[model samples]
Target chain A: MALDIPSPAALQLTASPAAVSAALTTTQVRVTSSFRGARIVLYGAVFDPSTTPSDVVVIVRGPDLPVRIARKTKVAGVWVNSRPVVFRGAPGFYMTASTRPLADIAGFGTLRRLGAGIDHLAINAPLEQHTETRYGVRDVVVSRLGADYLDWRRAVVRLKENAGLYDADDKGVTFVDKDLFKAEIDLPTEAPTGRYQAEIILFQDGQPVSRKVRSLTVEKAGIERTLYLFAHRSPWLYGLVSMALALGAGWAASLAFRRN
Target chain B: MDLYLPIAEVSVNAPLLVALGALVGFISGLFGIGGGFLMTPVLVLMGIPPAVAVASMANHVAASSTSSVISYTRKRAVDFRMGGVLAAGGVAGAIVGVEVFRWLRLMGQADLVVALSYLVFLGVIGGLMLVESLQSILRRRSGQPPKPRKDRRPPWLYSLPLKMRFPRSRLYISVIPPVLLGVFVGVLSAVMGVGGGFVLVPAMVYILRMPAGVVVGTSLFQIIITTSLTGVLQAGRNQTVDIVLATLLLVGGVLGAQLGAKASSRFRAEELRALLALIVLLVGLRMGLGLFFTPDEPFILMTGMG
Candidate 1:
């Protein structure tokens, strides 16, 4: 089913093909015993035949969770973590891919409004709303600390990027023809298991004409899944079982070595 | 072959992990000490998270120590009464240690504290052992009689109450020393993610005046209990113990310990102590250097701590 909506720009927006406007090659990611990483291919066709697709940007984001970014400073001849910034809702995994450079496709204001890039993500600290305290940073008012806030935010992005959980690739998306485009997204081995959302935005004349969002489930499967569930669900039992296994293994090893 | 760790949530090479376990196990067997000090660092270097590395290494230590304990028991080398008293104190220390560990983690100083403690402890213990062993070796080579050990037991140890007899170790010292020693080792085991046998062995030899033959077995018995406790607590509290990873390491470690125990009989005691001292000193030096060196990345991102 296609949804045709009129944009404020008075442009007709439609996501097609109606049956499957945007689809992921696999809706589920299974983490088995030998799982290293996985690749996801997202493909779709823009239905606005009247106007050629100027830009296609695909954004994939993993489940959001609280994250803490810390900067280390040398203290008393040892490096110690200082000045920690805690983000209340940070994506565990994020990637942005586009047909061309994002700056070349649309203006910064439009891109930020659409939340199409890392800089536009709505991540905030716990005390962001309080003007007096401003996220536990001592004596720094929120209105006066714009530059410091940007620095902390940039630090978050830089650290996450180094951790292989956040990425951006301007050349990741390619157009097969006039209307069909595809993007490849990589899920690193350390990626957290959760629901991931992929949004395909069709831009014409540097304006977003249509957008389609699809979700994929990434979860552990088989023995991996069972173990993870057991550990989280009944941690006491898991601990007991682990201890018993360790004890038994040691005993068995002793017996085996004694024979030799 | 690649194997996925359920708890750590990472895939790693199975054989490489096993090889690392074997290498550490051989050293433990040859030196009569738990190998956690070496194993934990190697696992962290192999891209495993530091928390997971510490927890899983505890499990590996428990298993390896058990195997050695069995062998030592068969040879009548273990002082069970002393081990029991030490373990009793160790359990209490481990409980307190876990709380301290949690507090340090909240303050974001867990890594720094653990690393610093490791460097200081290893440096002092390794340096002392090296000098003592070298002196003994030189005396033998020069055809001089070995110097008599001084009555170095502190005055406080003699005055403590609750004295007990340990016939196996030929000591009638107060039980307070062994118990307090166990408590100190337990704290080290929890915070530094080591079995604490490195500290225990030297303490028993120099302070408690236990026979060298009995020290190894008694230390292994205490290690088995304390590390097992640490592993269980870490699994329950932090969910950081990776069972699959521990199993791979244990498999190789058990075999290597057997070979190491066999080779232990071949080397002279002074030479073995000297070699162990060198290894400990090297590890300490490396960690100590880390404190002074500037890291390539000054920023780090952590999850599940907000």
Candidate 2:
């Protein structure tokens, strides 16, 4: 059956594919869904729908955004949302959009963008770190930003890395029993104010079957901001203050009991 | 040492503390001894941080003692007048103990000294008590009338001046022994993480020849002084005194103590003494065994005034 699928409407060809991928490295991809082939997914910013691919199929991808991500609709039984999908590798590779849902099942997918599209990767099963069954997967692809888009950088998606976004020692996550396992990471004082994309990939026989792309955040709390106001430039002092507070509170409680 | 339990932070773990407190309180009530004799050592054995264990035990002691003491006082089982004199001495001893603790800490010998002293004291005193009670049983079995000493004080304790009368105990003798014993128990209080009642009660009965009526109250009075000081000192130094931990033990101890006191009334005095002896023997064996054949060094052997 023929369907009037959504595709990019005001499409244009300014720069060649090679030049577009080179110029728009990571954060310089425009969302234009032009359905010419068996269209699968569309990668674009949520702000401009006109740039989003339609006529075939569309799925908003890429995280590292400034605001909230909302749910759009479902293809089958799985929930699809207007969010960022990150593929950790170079940009400028052809991604074929599959017309049919992955596994024709409820909760799994392997999607990619067509021409002028961003790269995509998928995983198998979910993992919960608390349990003993742990899983991990890794895949990278080059994506292209349309010539007219502002900037699209070569988005790198490593299956595992530490995140300082949580103001911990590391970033990203590992799949443990279908749950997420994030190690500690350090957060720089001048880090950007946006959501970073990190996906938990599950592998079966070295190939991804199930996947979950998560948006991580980096922001200062009120108390953290107040402390930063004076010594906002020093991360070392900020860490010291946090340790001091934990220790001080413990000491004060003991003192109060001792007095009574 | 990773010795401290994170339960002090979690609200869900409160029940464990309470249950432990109640069980220990019941045993303490039954045996007529402060649970610290068992608890402090048990916590230490179970790998609790010494500072937290001792401070927490002290808080537990205060709660447990008050639990039983209140009921004993209401029932006219506690003799306040006699308790007052011992408390006077106890206060003085506690002050000296605190000073000694500071001096020992400065010398970097507090841990070893406290532990060693407890090991020696428990070994010697517990052994002596066991021997005496066993001998008494043997004499009874032999069907011989027990040879009794004349009803007169030993010359040294009797000869001292400042002989004062204790109305409740009805004794007129020197106050020196009780005071000295008070001092000794007080020093022990800090070192051992006990309320000092175990030492105070026995010393009163044997050394001072105090009437039974006065024993519990006097020991309780001494405990109040020593433990209160201990609480403050530990908090000031180690900052391990968790109010939440203390509060849980107190609630459980109070309720358990009340129930224990009622249960005590149902048993005869002779039966109670027999049961107390068995408990004393058991605790003494547990401590004594810790001293000799055990590979893991009894930590008590390395503490206070040693």
Candidate 3:
């Protein structure tokens, strides 16, 4: 589905300088049993069309979750997991779309400050303080593993990327007219269920002038929701019910076979 | 028909799951086993998370064994007195197993432990079964009867305290051995997600010296209790039980088991044992190869625990 901001709204916004607003085609994604994937369009308007052209950056981040990353090493000629590190508040889903390459749009410092790209994404651990001085991009995440911390951080991004949970597009945003702009993001089947924030930023002169945040939710629906809730909210009851269903099914099958 | 499983949090082909369940069920019914040993590995291969595969298959095994126990009871082949003692020990073992499973998961070693257990148990059991069955088959071909297994209880077994008489099996022995056997099988069922039939059957025959006729029946009866408890514990503790997945599997399993039981009458017992042993060995070999092979991805990610 294509999202379109009304032209009248853009015209009204044009009266006020440096104003931007965006909305997703659908704010709530219902993940039923048959759900495969979904494509959502983020459309918005730029207020000052007559002014110098500005770049648009869109970032969609899913709910933060605690994750553990484990690396395997060969031991006794067999591959086994050796060291595991846990990172808290890591986004389960993260995607970035921009009018131009993030590096070309702004300097590394500015991009890092804005958190505009995958490399600049913030991932933190709770223990062992350390500073990353790689290529003059100083970011600090606490870790006791010394230099291995960077490897773990990169591993998170690499693993998430392989799972289709992290993505970035250099030229994902496009302008349809002088003031109308849109970006399309594909939410894969592996997307986690939670609230996702879509941030739309208008960058002018290599600086973010105005930003708007739109949020969407991905949630289980129908039988999927019922079962998920049943399993989590009341696990003991769910277990009993599971046993009852299995026993009943077994008893019925036995009776049927016996009668024949 | 791809369907999303809520608990496993993955989409799997519905028909594929049913067919897998049917295949395991057929084998179980033919052999009078629980089939969990076969089912869990296949599910893991299908990309269902290992923990979910183990727990949900326990549920499936419980159902399948329940059906088999009924027929065994009707045949008057079950030793309820022994089964009860074994089940008591099994319950205790299952409780401990679940805790260990959770601990292993937290340490990110549960999958490795599961695979290694399968390889070791399947390799030893399958190899032994194959050798014994092949020898019997060879003996029958030469127009000779199979050698009678020594049914004498060990000297140490007689001196143990808390002895009890099992009238059905016609044995008076210490309850310690049976309880210990039950605990070992119970731990196996919880950790490896098996009905523990393959292991239990051999131990009963060789160690407990149970009659061959009652061995299968009593094993099924014990499995029904142990696995049901394991399923409940896994669901309550780990929240890994997928009802939808289990139901689909049960539907195909119940139907397949009935057909397999009917077909079992046509095959020679020795031939069946040889076939089952080969299948078990093959599964073990595959599991072992996984440990040796270099994985495409050496890094793993787990969520929910910090």
Candidate 4:
């Protein structure tokens, strides 16, 4: 029920993905909005429509968090009290809530909640779920015909695929698969004549799985390159253009207002 | 005063900006556009890097728009058909802004062009705003309601072709002026690093004679569209948009605008214009001074980096 509500505090972002795993149906979700105000620190998370609020693990972890929040107990072979303990913050503590209690291998396996009876929760046998995360550009291959050699405007780049496991589909469907993922970098004609590098990363369950690196080269053209260097090297020319632009823009603005 | 923002580290210093959203909201609550002239320069001085400031301002304006547009819809201050026509022309002009920025950057002359435009255009705008507000103030002091520009076609604009019929402004204007205003703002945005609100808001209030009711909302709609694109592009290109930064500014701006909207009605139209005029003049002065006396340092040579 809470999933439908948009959390203003959530760091929401939207990205254009051209692949099955890349296209996020609901890219913007309430990550969480917990901030300490005056006294109490607010901790919250949205309940997926299918799951009850009690069943979800709303973990709070950082420095000085409680190790245990709840414990399961059985009396007369009839389960009664699910242990709930709130610990006072000491120093560096982190808190995590999980519906799956360890002692059994799979934690809170695949949940197929049936209308109003019971959600079929089995042992975690690789819970069929996937999340698409963004990794920085790892490596880039740039071809520039050396400064004062090749035309600066004609720089081209072929970004080869940086392989990573990405979510295929999660429309409440069975069995999610891996999808091809990559980044497309766009360059403006004004890129500086130099070398630049970027890094790429892969993540699973809020953890880094892999990483890579890449680079690019920016070179200048002939005639203009010489002219550009000459103009910039000579301080006078730079000042000249700066003043000229200031005067021109001033003139244009005046014209806009003066027309009336 | 806790004015320093956390993520951007850019303290919002303008007293007028701190009060503007509240002021505008107040008037928009009462009469309208009482203090619009102040919005642009105030945002600039706050160190929002121009583009995002305008976009954020626009988005904030949308909230105000949400409020007033409802009333304007009731009062019919907004001639729906006319606004649509202007918006259509404006979109065509807006495309030019992106190109102009790219072109200027290609020449490694973006800052130069931007600074120059600010000097030239803002001078005229600031001068006009000051003079007009002063005159209006005098007229009101002399016990006159200062009959608004009842019906006069600004000669130069009226002279152009592609005439348009705007019922609310009650004039048959040339499509050229509005479209040109749109393009001019678009190009200005690239150089100015604005979402075009600084240019367009004044154009609407002073040039087009839009009832104050429609100006903020109409301008905001455009700002939202432009800025949202800008947000995506900035994310794609620079990857410098720290969501934390944007959120901090948004948080401050949203709260500020709410207060500005409430402060609107306490001041008269002339008073608002006077404050606006003062803001523009201050920005103009700052730019003018920088022009004559730029810092004594070997300015880093900006080699073209697309």
DockQ scores of the candidates: 0.65, 0.02, 0.61, 0.01
- Tell me the tens digit of each residue's lDDT in model 2 across B24-111: 7776666566677667766656445455566666667766666566556655767566666666776676666766766655454554
The C-alpha stretches of model 2 lying farther than 4 A from their native spots are A1-260, B1-12, B102-109, B137-150, B236-238, B265-306
Scoring only the A-chain of each prediction against the true A-chain gives TM-scores of: 0.84, 0.25, 0.84, 0.23
Q: What is the TM-score of chain A in candidate 1?
A: 0.84
lDDT of 3 by residue, B1-306 (tens): 999888888888999889988888888889989999889888888888888989998889988888777888988999999999999999999999999999998988887888798789899999999999999999999999789767667888889999999999988999999999999999999999999999998899888888889999899999999999999999999999999999989988876776677788899989999999998899888887788889888778864355
Q: Which stretches in model 3 have alpha-carbon errors above 4 Å?
A: A1-19, A128-142, A176-179
Interface RMSD of 1: 1.4
Q: Give the TM-score of candidate 1.
A: 0.93
Q: What does candidate 4's lDDT look like per residue over A52-78, in tens digits?
A: 112212111112212112222333442
lDDT of each: 0.82, 0.46, 0.86, 0.39
> Which regions in candidate 4 have their CA more than 4 angstroms from the true location?
A1-260, B1-76, B144-150, B154-164, B195-198, B205-217, B225-242, B301-306
Error of 3 at A163 (Å): 1.2
Worst 10 residues of 1 chain B by lDDT: B297-306
**A183 in model 2: Cα distance from truth in Å?**
4.1
Q: Give the higher-lDDT candidate: 2 or 4.
A: 2
Better of 1 and 3 by TM-score: 1
lDDT of 2 by residue, A1-260 (tens): 11111232212222222110001113221111111111111121111113322112212222222211121233343222322222222211112122223232112322232111232333211221122322443332213322311221221211111111111111122222222122222222223323333332222222232333333443334432343332324433432343233223323433343355
| Alpha-carbon shift of residue B240 in model 1 (angstroms) | 1.5
Tens-digit lDDT track of model 3 for A1-260: 11221222232222236868888999999888988778999999988645776889898988877778888888998888865677765688888998898888877887776666878766766654676766766785436767777888888899999888899998899988878999998988789888888888787777666778888999999999999999999998999899888878877888999899
The order of the candidates by TM-score, greatest first, is 1, 3, 2, 4
How much is the lDDT of residue A147 in candidate 1? Answer: 53
